[model samples]
Target chain A: MSEHHEKPEISPAARRFIIALCVLAAVLVALEFIIHRHAYFTTEGQPLFFAVYGFIAFIVVVAGGVGLRKLVMRDIDYYDQGERDE
Target chain B: MSSLVTLLQIPGLLLVFGAAVVPFLPHKLRQAYMLAIIALSAYWCWGIDVGTHLSTNLAGLDLTLVRAEAITRPFALVFHIAAALNVIYAMHEKSRLTATSGLAYAGAAIAALFAGDFITLFIYWELTAFTSVFLILVSGTPRSFAAAMRYLLMQVSSGVILLAGAVLLWHGGQGLSIQAMQANTLAGGLVLLAFGIKAAFPFLNGWLQDAYPEASVTGTVMLSAFTTKLAIYMLALCFAGTEILIYIGAVMTLFPVFFAVIENDLRRVLAFSLNNQLGFMVVGVGIGTELALNGTVAHAFAHIIYKALLFMSMGAVLYRTGTAKASELGGLWKKMPLTMIFCIIGAVSISSFPLFSGFVTKSLTIGSVAKDGYFVIWMILIFASAGVLEHSGIKIPYFAFFGHDRKFEVKEAPLNMLIAMGIAAGLCIVIGVAPHLLYGLLPYDVKYDVWEAGHVLGEMQLLIFAILAFVFLMVRGWYPPEIDSTVLNTDWFLRRALPRTVNALSRPFLAAWASAVAQSKTAILAVLHTGEETSRKSGLVSGVASTGAAAAIFLAIFALLLLLRFVA
Candidate 1:
């Protein structure tokens, strides 16, 4: 069996945005190797510390929200008992 | 200077009492009058210096009405600026109630800043609540009314709790003067609880997200400036360096990030974002170092301008499009390009991109946490920084202006709103570029180097990579989609659980009361029926004899009594 990855259709502008993002991320990672960051802790001193954390943290926050929605989400008029205005 | 001390009335009285004339003035006159009053109030407030205070005897306790702290200058300055911006942003507003209440609300908050005693502070605290509640009420919807009531309940509860703590302080031989105290003390704990509620600390944060976004288009902007920041000012004054605040602030910083992600309402997302921003200040207060305190003050000042700018842009969008939900708004960049630019500026400023306000100010606090060797908390703060970028920096702009093109046929935001956003954006940039301007007003001298290359590189890497992750998620369809829904928060305890609990608890009592009432009615009717059967006419009245018969009986009784008395 072969695993298939779904690549959603996108506009050209969005595709360009993704490419520009990749370029920027690469530049930042390259700059990290050149610059000496003032790290207060051992983990912070690790190479590409901020870049790794930033990328992972953003993913985690969004993923956690996806899980949270299942538990907490309700209709817009949840509290008003359907007294929402037009 | 001594003679001038006699001339110093309370700083914000001009706006508070002067609001009386607001209702009577015409539109242009009202706007001009409000601006003039704010200018005059700011001028009067400027003359006040620490130790140059006026006191009066109230019920044998001396009350200071015009005391100033070193931190008071910056808070007062930003507050006046916010007030003036409100007047400008509301230039198109014709509702006299919003005008009067807005001015009075701003005035009360400024007054609270200068209060020297708990009693005086409590007065201004409740005044801010009473005046600003109208902003929520002005939305004129059932939800807004409910929100206003809940907002008032929390505000008034804070005031009452503050007073209770003050009385306990006085009872404990501590003067009623507002000063630092041990959080372990009963009075100190009570006071901290009160401040925590207004600061939107953890479970006490419900009212902020609940009420703010529900306010009218411009009203939400006015509502944002005063209340929580006032609580933060008090927290810095009273509870700075408390160890508990460190953990509490950390919790505050992280939880809102997740909630903001899936929230459909853009304004409410900002509210959650505001809560997240506040966590930084709280953490700064917890650190209680010179650098950290300066960071808190500087962050509050910059946060005020940028937050207001962000809210104003959204308000402009709401005003024209008649919706602020992320799911509803899209492709507004062409329609309100100026608003989009202003929103982006606010986003970058909040995201702490280099050369923005957050970079200079938020660094001092995070730097303090790191320097203090709290590695875990520091990491949490860093992660929270990325989370801030996700919601405020990218999501707000992406969904509202760039994502799904709803093709809203809306015009540009009003001229006055543009001017307000322009001025606020200009301030954010000025403070960001030359942080020394804001630093000079801080309580302590700043030693933190915000622009160090090493720090700058780290910050840029953090922010840029965060954006990359956002783009990555979007392209892959891994990001959570905004849907119209109610996201349960701590407010669920107040809005849902509390009411449901009350109804559940009262059910038995209500049922028993109903049964008792029915039994009483039956017993009364039975007595009446028994009397009616005997008399045939009706109850007790029918048992009475005719007039002549009654007179004869009375005479017989009187004669018998007379004979008995003679025999005795």
Candidate 2:
């Protein structure tokens, strides 16, 4: 089933968007050193504080969410079965 | 002053009852009439004087029906505007019930906002719940009907708790005023719980995620605009500065990020995102400072528009394609470029990207929390902002429009829907660019600069890094693939566990009761048979002799009585 459908190619416009986004992220990271931040706490003043925090947080949330699936994920008909019996 | 008082407009009445006349109008006239009602209501709300008016003494308590303050004005305005847009979007829906109920729902929310006393607020609050359920049921799916039932139970429970809280408050000598009160007391705690339920706070949040996605395409868009925002208005009005709300808000912000990640339904993902957005406003209300409250109002204003836009795009997708599940959709952007663009705008606005509506409004809450030295909470909020970017900002558009192409060919959204989305999308950008337009409506004076270099840079770093993280995950196959499935949440307890538990607990009891009823029925029938037999045995003799014998006995007695009376 997976082999039957050809993998869709990324369009030129989408490719440009991805490239531009990568470049923009790199530029923004460099600006963290040049820009003066009015940091609220001592740790936030560190270089790349937001970048590091945001990246780690995103991974943690995603990984945590996947783990949660182990606990809460059920067959799509989980509720539907109950409704039928009801 | 007397003449001015008499001239005061009750937009709530106009919206609520005026919608009842919609079915009487011809088909073409209905749309014009609906739009006219909304416009007139908007005009009425805008012209409302900045004071409590329409006070009446009822049952020895003063009830103020219209309280137009700066804090509530923005919420009411956005609700009216969103409702009008909803009317436009649904102009082609052909269901008078949807149109009428939608109008009444909006009217109830607006009325609840302007309510000066708990009694008035509770009336409109329950009205919203009662009327909005029709929108959900209008979807006409069995699942939607079930979801609507659950939604109504939850909502009406909130209203009942609110009424109980009001009664308690009145007994506590607080009078039925709708003002900030300490949550330490029983009454205050009950009221807070009520608002918490409607606000979709944590465990109480299941109804929103369960029902919003189950509503009709346009119904979801309408549902997105009201119920929860009304609770936010109430929170800002009464529960500000309450320490518990800050923690609650923070948790509200964080938990949905996880559920939204692997959720299959795109609309459900937006529902989760809506919960996250509400978290921001809750924090602002918790802070209760001028700036924080202002942030709450501005964020609510911005959220109503952009969230509606996001829901509209998904609705259009669902309208065109038969499903909104991410697993079933991809590469629709080529066919529905306009919807794609509108969805991306909504995504960016919600992501707090620079020059988007979220960037300006959400910062105020974050800034206030940081200033107040809630270092840990501020960090959590910042983290949740990134989480928002992942689920709502990237995941939604990626799977729905740009991921592995399923090669679906569908026309763009209908013209009225595009018009509605365009208007909402336009507002998102406008608010993002000229936030002062929103800021001016705040209850407090504006002093915070949203365009400061530090704030903007920090925001950009957080958002951009989050985007990179998404890219890395997608490229490395670390991202969870969307599957056709439902992820259980707190609603599982009510929808499945509670019913099964009840069934388990009641089966034996019900059997015993049924047996007992059968036994009792047999005993009663036996007794009735015995009585009938006794009566039958005596019936012939009594029937034959009764009339003539009774008359003779009566005459003899009467003669004896007459003789006795003469002797006396």
Candidate 3:
């Protein structure tokens, strides 16, 4: 399946748009320092706490999911192989 | 709203009995009848006054069939609306069993919400499990049939545990009341466990992921709305502020995001995301503050709409393309642009984008968590919110619509599906923009504002950064590709490990039992033979004794005794 279709390459324009969006997001994170952020915890008062937290949390979740897939993923027929339909 | 109907006219019954009449109707009228039932029920939900409606004695206990309170009213409202929308969405479906059972399941869920006593709640609770199983089974595939069995068992087990808890509560002199309980007693803990199972708390959650995706497309949409939300309503009613729920809710919020990320099945991803969304409501229920409870109810209301929207879109995709696995789906936006748009709306709503329904509702819970000063939980919840963005926000839309082009052109979703999704998507936006439409329906007085600058900025930062992370991973090819594989969860115990263990355990046990039966059979035969021989010998002896020989012997002995006496 992978060999049948070439992976679609990101258009340069789309790439530029993505980069711009990332920069805009970075600017928002930077603006958080000046914004009067209501920090629930004292530690959360730091600049870009949510940005860093969101980034790391997503990575952790994705990484954790990858690890879990390695442990638990099986052939699609894993549960369906038997005729236990009584 | 209150002047239109008397208390005795329970809205839920209109749905329940109306569903009974569905199978009798001609195929053309079935859809219309279902729609009418939902409409009438919705009208009743709005009209019924906020008080106990019907009280009756059953088996020496009082059961209340309809009780409307501030909390129950909102849940009932959303349930009816969701049912109605689901009916409309499923209008094209011709399956009588699916239509009938779906309506019945919806009605049972509504009735369970209105139930003022544990007995009534229990009746409706188990009814939901029984009726909804038909929806799964009506798919008529062996996989769905098997999934339905597991789904039914898990659901019924929850109901049974609920009954046991109710009985214990009654024995403890609680008198069958359905109300908040302390977890110090056996009844309270059992009741919590029961609700937890339906609510898909952590390890007990596998059933939702296992069975829901396997349901028929329309059935999945109907299912996505009710069962768990019903349990959430029950939890809000019965186990508010139980403390342990706080931790459970936190864990519930976090774990599903991970599973959802790598999930190949789009519907299963939605299932995991559903679990994650329920976590927010659970946290609110755990907080048990008036604000938190209101948040929970309002969130459930919003979630039903948005989640159904998501499921309906995916259902459309599955209906058209014949597969919901992400591995087999991509670049569908070219043909199914309407569905893509709706899916994006759902994704945005669930992601808590600033102008979406989830923003208005989920923020309340996060705010309450922060206000209550549980810093760690508050942090975990924030993280989970971002995780929500990863799996539901990006993964759902990107893989299905915008990811690598699968070069498949399919027709747009059917008109009924688009209309249903349109209405749901409309509600998501309406509630997001004008939140008071939802806030006013909350169980408590509404004071919190969702558009506070700090909250808006913080949520935006979190969501945007999460998106950035996703883009980073995608561009770098670090993101996991969707595969045609099954990811294991707690269901492994019942579906895989337990079956194998049973097979392994039963073999030796069967052999030993066979040997034991053989030994017992030999011993029993020997005993029977001995008895037969002894009986034959005894029969001959008795036959001789009964005859003249015995009489002569007796006479001789008597004569001897008489002679001896005479001599003496």
Candidate with the greatest DockQ versus the true structure: 1
Q: What do the candidate models score in CA lDDT, each in turn?
A: 0.91, 0.89, 0.87
The order by descending lDDT is: 1, 2, 3
Backbone clashes in candidate 3 total 0
Off by over 4 Å in 2: A1-15, B1-8, B511-568
Candidate 3 chain A, poorest ten consecutive residues by summed lDDT: A1-10
Interface RMSD of each: 3.6, 3.5, 3.3
Clashes of 2: 0
Clash pairs detected, candidate 3: none
The TM-score ranking, best first, is 1, 2, 3
Least well predicted 10-residue stretch by lDDT in candidate 1 chain B: B537-546
Query: Which regions of candidate 3 fall more than 4 Å away from where they truly are?
Result: A1-8, A82-86, B1-8, B504-508, B517-568
> How many collisions per candidate?
0, 0, 0
Which ten residues in a row are the worst by lDDT in model 3 chain B?
A: B1-10
lDDT of 1 by residue, B1-568 (tens): 7544353378887789889899999999999999998998898888788774777879988788888998899999999999999999999988999999999999999999999999999999999999999999999998899999999999999999999999999999898998888899999999999999999999999999999999999899999899999999999999889988989999899999999999999999999999999999999889888888888999999999999999999999999999999999999999999999999999999999999998999999999999999988999999999999999999999888998899899899999999999999999899999999999989888988888888998998898888888877766767777789999999999877887788889999999999999999999999987776866643333545555566888999999999999999
**Given candidate 1, what's the lDDT at residue B184?**
95
TM-score (0 to 1) of chain B for each candidate = 0.92, 0.90, 0.90
Tell me the docking grade of candidate 2.
acceptable
Best by lDDT: 1
**TM-score of chain A, every prediction, order shown:** 0.79, 0.74, 0.74
Per-candidate interface DockQ score:
0.53, 0.45, 0.49
